[model samples]
Target: MALITRLSTQSESFNSALRTLLAFDASQDESIERATADILKNVQQHGDSAVLDYTQRFDRVSAPSVAALEIERREWLAALDQLPSGQRQALETAAERVRVYHDHQRAQTWTYTEADGTVLGQKVTPLDRVGLYVPGGKAAYPSSVLMNAVPAKVAGVPEVIMVTPTPDGVRNPMVLAAAAIGGVDRVWGIGGAQAVGALAYGTQTLSPVDKIVGPGNAYVAAAKRRVFGTVGIDMIAGPSEILIICDGATPADWIAMDLFSQAEHDEMAQAILLCPSASYLDEVEAAIARLLPTMPRADIIRASLAGRGALILVQDLDEACEIANNIAPEHLEISTENPQQWADKIRHAGAIFLGRYSSESLGDYCAGPNHVLPTSRTARFSSPLGVYDFQKRSSLIHVSQAGAQTLGRVAATLAYGEGLQAHAASAEYRLNLSN
Candidate 1:
C-alpha cells in the first residue's frame, strides 16, 4: 500500500482530481428521500407508535413507552462513579473547557433607541428543549456529547435529551457517563433516521424538540434534511476531511501518519497536503509507503489517499491557503515554521490545528472545540455546531406614536417600491392615525 497521488503547482488539475473521490452518492436519492418523508409523516401522525415500530425495526430495541426514553439519574450516577478517576477527571476537564468556550459564545441581548423614540433590539433566547444525536454503531463520542450538551446548557436551554443507537439494545456506559458530566437531561436508546424522526416530531414517550444537533451516517443526514423545515438542524455533514499545510518542518513519517488519521475514517474521507517543497513530498510518500502497510485499515486508507487525497506543491504560502479555502476542508492543519501566519490567511475551514503539536485528534476529543464541522465546502457558509445552535433569536421593536409617525412614511415608500400596496397602506394608515 502506498500514497499514489501527487500534483505540482505547475501541473495540478483540481477538476480531474475532484471527480474521482465522489463516493457514496450523497445519501439522497428518490428512495431515501421518499422513505425519510414517509417516516417523518408517520412519526408526526402516529407519534409514539410509529417511533416504537421504527426503533424495533432499525435499532432492535423495544422502546414502547415514554418511560423507556428517560435514563434515570440513578443510572447516570452509577455509570459516572464506576469510571476510574482518570477517566472521570478527563470528562470533567472536557466539560469545563466546553462550558467555558460556549459561555464566551453566549450572546448578549441588545437594544437601540432611535431619535424619534423608536426602540429596536435583538433578543436571544435559548430553546426550551433540544435533542442531540450521538453516533453509536461504530464508536461512541463522549466528546460529541460534551460539545452538543454543554452548548445548550450554556445557552440556558431547560432540557437536553440525547439519543444514540443501541443496536444491541444497550447504550454504552461511557456515553451515559459523559452525558452525566455534560448535564444531558435524558438519554434514549434509539438510532438511525427513526431516532431523528422521534426527536423532530415527538413520540408518545418523547416530546418534540425545538432543535436537533449532532452527526450521524448518511441515513441520519437525509432524515435531518427531510425534517429541517419542522425543526432546526445544525448542518448536513459528509465524510471527514483534513488538509495539512506543511513546508516539511515535520518528519515525512509524521505527515504521512496524519494523512492516514482522517483517511481511515471512511473510504471517501480526504487527506490532502499542500506544500512548497518537492523533496518533502517525496519523503512523505516514502513514509506513507512504509507506514500504511502496517495499519489494519490499510486498504481503506490507500483507496482514500489514491482517490480523494493528494500532495500538492504550491508556489508559496498564500497560494496554499487559497487552495485550502477553495477546498474548505473540515480540518485544516498548519505544520509550518510560523503556522499562525498561514492560519490567518485561511478564509474558510471547519476547524484549524495551529501547529504540528496540535493534532486534529486533540480537537476531536479534548481540545475544547466542537468536532462536528462543516463538510464538503459548506464551511464557506456553515459552522461547527455550538451554543448558538440550541438558541433562537427574535427581533424586538417598540415604537411610540411619534416614532411610528416619523418612520411610517419611509416604510410606506419602501413597501410601495416593492409593489406591496397592502403593506404600504397599512403603514400609511398607521401614520394617518398617529397624525
Candidate 2:
C-alpha cells in the first residue's frame, strides 16, 4: 500500500533490478556544456565588463563596476547585527565548533637530517585564496558559509571569497551574518555559471582563486567541470543520498525521520533503508506513511520516495552491510544495538551517523566533522572536504656531499635508461663536483 518500492533478497530478479535502480547518468547535458563554455570565454576575455553584463542579465544586480558587488567587512557585521539573539548565538556556536574540530586537522612542516647530512622532509602551505559558491536567494544556506569558509581560514588561507546568486538584488541577512561569524574575507552577490566563471577565470576587480568549493545548480556544476584545470575545484557532486541499516531494535520513528532528512533535499535525492528484519521494515514503512502528512515538504518527499527511494529486506545485517559498501552512499546511518559492529564493516561512505541520536542534520550544522561530503559513490576514491583540501605539500630533499654520490649513481642510471643524456650528465656533473 506504501508509495515506495519494497524489495526482498528472496526475490528472483532482485540483483538486476537493484542495479538498474542504482544506475544514475552523471553525464552533463550537452546544451549546458555549450552555454557554460560560452560564459567562461566571455568572462575570460572581457573580465569585469563581462561579469557586470551577466550580473545584470541573470541576477538583475546591475552595479556600475564589479567592485560594487563586494559586500565589505562592515556590511557583513551589520548583517550580523540584524540577526535575532538566538540565531546569532547559534551561528557563533556552530562556527566555533567547526573551527575547533578543523584545528586538529591542521598540517605542519617538518624536517630531519641524517648522518650523511641529507635533509628529507615535507613543507605544508595553505592556499593563498579560495572561492566559495553558495546558492543564494530563497535557497540561501547560512550553514554553507560556515562550512566552506571556516575550514579554509583554519588552514591559514589568506582570503576566502564567496559568490552567491542574489536574484533581483536581494540578499539574505543570515547568510551575510554567517560570513561574518566564519571570518570570510569577501562576499559577492552573484550566482549561476557566470559566478563560477568569475571565480575560475577572474575579472578586473575580483582576483581568481587557487580553488573553488561549495555547491550549485546544473549550470554551476557544468561550469565547475569545465574550469577544473584552470583553477582547482572541490568535486562535481551529485544528488544527496543516505543509506540506513537498522537491527530493528531501534524505534521505527527514528529511522523514518532519518530517511526523510535526505529525501527533502530535492526530488532526485535518494533515501534507502536495508534491514534484516522484515517486520521492522514494515514498521518503518508504516511510520513513513503516517508521518508523511506532517512534513512541510511532504510533496517533495512523496515524489522522491515514489521515484527513487526504496525499502529493502535483506537476508541479514551482514548482507545489508555488504550491499551498503556497493552503494557507497554519501550519508550512512547505522541505527542498531551494536552500531559499531556494523560500522566496522563499512568500507565506504562519506560520513557515518552511528546510533539513533547521531542524525545527519547534526553533521550538516554543528557536529565536529565537515558536512561537505563526497556524493554519488565518489566515496570509493574521494573523501570529505577538510583543512587538507586547502593545504598543499611540497617534498624537500637536500642531498649532502656523501648523499649525492650515492643518489647520483641511482639517478644517472635511471636517467640514462630513460634516454635523456642531459639528465644523466646533470647527475654525473653533480657527482664529479662532490667528489
Candidate 3:
C-alpha cells in the first residue's frame, strides 16, 4: 500500500526523488551481443536448422520448418471467423480504431521548390518489409498485433511479417485473428532471439525485414540492440511503468487498482503516485490493502509495489509537475481538478492521461494510442511506437543553376575548410558549370 502526501520540498529534493524513481540502467546482465552474435551466426550458417534448435531449446517445442513456417491467408481468415462474434467484433473495432488513428500519422511524399528553383523536401517511403515480434509467454495479446501491424499497414509497408513464440507448437487463434484484422501478410510460429535473427538475416523460410518493431522480454530487447545495425529497431524497451499525480479527490481503490495493473506486468515494473494531500495518500493505502488481495497475480503486484513503487507527497502542484517531468514516466495520469493546467507543466512523459476518467488501462487496451511506449525515463528522448516506425525518410534536393551558383561557393569553402578536396572540387565544378 502506498501512502500519499502533499508536503513542501526543495526543487533539488524533488528532482532527486524523480531521478531515483525513473532511473533505469540500460546496461544489465546477459551479454546480448554475445547471445545475439552467437544466435545470428547459427541462423546465418544453418538458417532454419538453428531456428528450430532454439525454438526447441527455449520454447520447448519443435518449430515448423521453412516449408511450414508461414500461416496461409485462408487459415488466418478462418481463425477470425471461428472467433466468437463478440470477440471478433472487438478485434475489428480495435483494429479499425488503430487504423484510423495511425492513418493520420502517415507521412506523405512532399517536394517544395523555392523561387530560386532550389527544390528541398522530404520523401517518405514505407519499408519494403517489416517484422513484428509478439510475446506468447503470457496470454496472447491480439492488441499487440493491432498496435504493431496496423501502423505499418497505415504506413503502406508492402509486407508486414509477424513472429510469435508457440510453446505448444500451436498458434493462438486469437493471434491469427488479430493478424487478419491488421492485414499482416504472414505469421510465423517462431519467437525469441531466433525470430529476430530470422527477420534480420533472412532464413530459408522468412524473408529479411528492413525493420522490426514490437515489445518483448529482456532477451528480445538485447537481441534487437545486438542486431541494430543489421536491421532497424523501435527502442530498447524497459519494464512497464505508471505514475499518477493526484489531488486526492479520486477514490483510493481506483488509484490502487491502477497501480496494481502496471505492477503485475513484471517484478521490475514500477507504479508510483504523487499526491499533494496526506488524507488522499492514507485513503489510497487503505484502498490498496483492500484491493490487492482480490487480484489473481497479487504476489507479483505486491513485490513490484514493495520494491519499485512508491508514494510521494509533494508540497504543491508545481512540485508535483516538476517531479513528474523529471521522472519522465511511461504512463502519467493527472488526476487533479485542473489536470490540463497541471499537464502543461509536465515536460517529459511518454503518454499523459488527463483527468480522473482517463485511466491508463484504456490506453493499454482500447484507446487508439499505441501502448508501446518509451520506458525507464527514455521518454526524455524517444516516443511511443507508431506509423513513423515503419517509414523511412529521404531528403530530396534539386538545385537549379542559379541556386547552385548561389550555394556552391559556400559549400566549396566549407568542404575546403574540412580538408576534403574531392568535396570542394565537386561543388566548385557545379559552380563553374553554372558560370
TM-scores of the candidates are: 0.92, 0.97, 0.93
lDDT of 1 by residue, 1-435 (tens): 335677776765655554554333564678777888888788889887887788788877776484675668788789999999999999999889878877888887999998878899999999998989998866887888898898899999999989888786666778899999999998877777888999998877788998899888767888999889889888888888999999888888888888999999888898999999998898998899899999999989998898788888888888899888888889999998888888889889999998878888888878888888998888998898888787789999998778878688999999999999999998888775634
Go through the candidates in order and give each one's C-alpha lDDT: 0.85, 0.90, 0.85
Q: Which scores higher on lDDT, 1 or 2? A: 2
Angstrom error at residue 89, model 2: 1.2
For model 3, which pairs clash? Answer: 4-281, 5-313, 6-276, 7-314, 7-315, 8-315
Candidate 3: 10-residue stretch with minimal lDDT:
1-10
- How many clashing residue pairs are found in candidate 3? 6
> On residues 71-109, what C-alpha lDDT tens digit does candidate 2 reach at each position?
778877998998899999999999999999999999999
User: Could you say which candidate leads in lDDT?
Assistant: 2
lDDT of 3 at 419: 97
Model 3 spans with C-alpha error above 4 angstroms? 1-26, 31-34, 432-435
lDDT of 3 at 386: 91
Show model 1 residue runs off by greater than 4 Å.
12-15, 18-24, 27-31, 63-66, 416-422, 429-435
